[model samples]
Target: MAARITARRPSPERRRTARMTSSDWANPYGVRKPYGSNGANHGDGGEKGATLSADHPLVPWKQPDHVHQWVDVDHSREELDRFVRNWPDLGELLDANVGHGRVVIVSGPPGMGKTTLIHRCLYEVQQRVAATGPSAGDPLAVFVPTAGLENDGRRISVDPDGSFAPTRLINARIRSEITKKLLLHEFSESRVRAITAEEDPYQAYGEMSDLLVQRNALLFAVIPHIRWNDAHLRAAFLRTCLSHAHTRIVLFVEVSHGAAETAREVAAALSGSAAVTHLALRELNSEDIWRFSRSARAANGAPNGLVEPDRSSLMAAHDEWKPSDVRELRKVFHSAADALRRAPHPWPIDADALRPHWERRRAGRDALLRHPILPRSGG
Candidate 1:
């Protein structure tokens, strides 16, 4: 018994390195660094970056803060109800455009949630059309994000079939969107192929519109950042509108204070001097920011988001920072959430708590600017 107790001679298998579960391998005293599928390190959450579970308290910060990013309110109704600041104004504009061949201009300052607002409104319009239309299926809402269209004006893409495509940049984008939506809705697969094969964007658009009309379904042609000076582009858009006389055309224009007159001219021409509905978004106030941030978190499934005291602290911090727009404010929130997720910090974080993060970010940015690449050695 004494000899056996001295230590059972380890078996060959038992002598091997002990197997450890992932939890045992994880650092107990420090944050576990996550790696994405590409082997890139991600420290935003215990999981992949921006993929935190819905119940996570840091969920709100996961939202993309870019001005051009369109939030799909169809999938996030809670966020739509909470963050959409200009719903009443948008409702009136959409109400006027229903079943009418009219262009509505949605104007707002940069980063004022113009794109998000339009997305939510259009989603609502789609739902209404789906529920009340004579069609058996959902309506089609085609969005053409013509970013950098000014530089890529009328540029053509070489097709895979080794032919020069006649479709312009915006029109081609529309065709692609139509084909994608049709396939998603399980519409006629043959029709999807036909739309994809069509070389003329306008003709493809007309054909798609005709199909939708036959189903008595509504079609929304949403184009954003359309300037008034692009006569050729505007004429092309007009042709599409003319072909689909009953389609809802929405032109989302970002309005700078200095360019008010230019925006008005754009609204006039795009509307063809017809009665145009206008929905203008105002800048976010302090309360709006607070409420929006809270709702954003809640929308992401954080039912226990910032309490009243925490919200007050956040608002004070935001006021002191004086973020120029919602976009900047979002960046602040995202950074704060990221920091908290990395290390569990006390609740109701104030300016003092957030200053370190800002300083670190500034230092990192400065270091990058000072030396974007490693210094070269003498050859």
Candidate 2:
């Protein structure tokens, strides 16, 4: 008989790591089709694997920087046009070698396209910078989502004095977030690992800043929703980022309109001493949504003979859902199109037809938006 061959099962931690490392798990947002593709996809939840039709008014929905497309900025769309026109000052700030620290607070209601706008602006700046020439000192914008920075769902080491406990924990989380971004930027993996391993997170962060400075690169970190309680931790991180004194770094803090206190705290941390820029995004009304939809339809151009939504049907769905923000509007239209596609005939589909489907998806979608990414602890 052959010697007994036993395959030791992977440790729980290893198994968890394997699961988290999967493409779908890493990017909760599923693989996006090439830009200008008729349909888009959200990750596996709510409307699991639901693909919008090419001719759907909201086919190419708003997305993060990784999947952003220049074509999404339709000049005919009032909101998109105004957002781009009013956004130049900050864009200039990011591209300029100002050699100082600054903070830009972009406040808006939930689902108002704050992240999408910021990503688009940064994407434009990147394009312009490339046209000028490639240099180490070029400004590099890094997006850092802060939802997971809070508690991180990991048991923390108790500290009686409470002096460094929160700082240590939050710093580690922040360091991890930045490390992932740097790796994506093609920074050395071994070097990144070594830097993250530094005992002091602030020191490690400073090393990150120095690395950018050495290459004459500026780091524009876009962190959304800095909780009121975590304001100080963010402030501390900002201080570390500005350590270079000569290396210009920008911190773009995004908060919902309801989080006034959080925004004030983060701004106060700057003490009115550092350069600060503020912009507010208002929720869209039905008219604005209608205008955006019409403009998008024209700009995106549907396939010939493809049943397109008329304003009446689109308005009917809008009235049914009564969407409160850009995000909700996108979902409403996308779901309406999905319903139309599933119909036995190409007859017009309205909100009533999508109501049951939308209702069933509401709870799951709300939960997902609340915690888009709950990063598991550990490497």
Candidate 3:
């Protein structure tokens, strides 16, 4: 007697439901139904079963390891010479103690070339190091620009308008920006994470201080603007660097008329310490202006090679020209040079104005004069 064997099979309704469940799992929000089989319609709609393709590239891909080269500025020979001459003590100080732990502060009026000189120093120092192998523990120069401190503070989101939220904010923005950039560019993620996670901002600062000291790094701060409470900011900076006695920190503050008093006060505080040395920057002379124009023209290339005549020709033609005249010519060349650099079609300045041009082309002259780099006629 054979036992009757029966196997239970899923009902048709059950099979259909299973298939439907699988389909629902594949496209939960009915995106495929309305949008066809194409994987679209995932908009702001909260659909559950959607997934991005596996190979989608993300923003901020690992940047190549880049060594930031110092920026080059073209100052006239005269201006460079004058700066060196005026700040003879600074040159001496740098020469003597740069190997040791000496901090030099170059502060002065805006557009007076504080940034320029610092760049020059960095380039020179690096060049010296490269030419002659560094002595044991010779400090390596590091230039940090303080132009974007507010943005660095994360106070102003950098998404929309790029302006600072408030003008009165302390312009320690440069320090913040430089710190962020240095962290991003120079340090490892784990090291940065460890340093930044410290409770006090000054702790991270102290870490940088120690790191620089260990590496014998010379830090040059290019501060273009300062606020009323800049002393507090500077104190924090000094404390951070001074915590490690071997770290040398140079502060180059570019003083604007509005911020001159504050800059002076900050400089006074920094100067109170023997470790810090302060030097004021002065306006470039005509020769310096000429050299700057020439270098800028050569490096950037002038329009039609006519924006600025050869330096010798310019000097010869304008030998009798007043310093003011040379200044105006340099401005014209700078404007034309900039325009050439930025635009596909270059605007050429009148070659004659490298000497003297026709009065009829006054409009052209006015156009060139309108460049922001050019000083206003009366001023």
* Candidate 3, 1-379: lDDT as tens digits: 2222222333555434433322222211011211222222433222344432211111110101001111122232334444444432323333434443445555544334344455454444455544443453445556565553211222321212433223213323333555675564565556555655555544555565566655555555555433213345445544444332233445544433322344456465555565654555444344543453443321111112223324543433333432222223334444444333343332223233323322333345433211122212221
Instruction: Please give the ranking of all candidate structures by lDDT, highest first, separated by commas.
Output: 2, 1, 3
Q: How would you order the candidates by TM-score, starting with the best?
A: 2, 1, 3
| Model 2 steric clash pairs | 136-215, 137-216
The C-alpha TM-scores of every prediction are 0.52, 0.57, 0.46
State the TM-score for model 3. Answer: 0.46
Worst ten-residue run, lDDT, model 1? 53-62
Q: State the TM-score for model 2.
A: 0.57
Q: List pairs with backbone clashes in candidate 1.
A: none
lDDT of 2 by residue, 281-359 (tens): 6655546545544333212222211133345544555555545565555555455544544444443334444465456
Better of 1 and 2 by lDDT: 2
lDDT of 2 at 187: 78
The lDDT, on a scale of 0 to 1, for candidate 1 is 0.41
Per-residue alpha-carbon lDDT of candidate 1 for residues 182-244, written as tens digits (9 for 90 to 100): 666666788878877888755675566556555444345445443323344444554454443
For each candidate in the order shown, give its overall lDDT on alpha carbons: 0.41, 0.46, 0.38
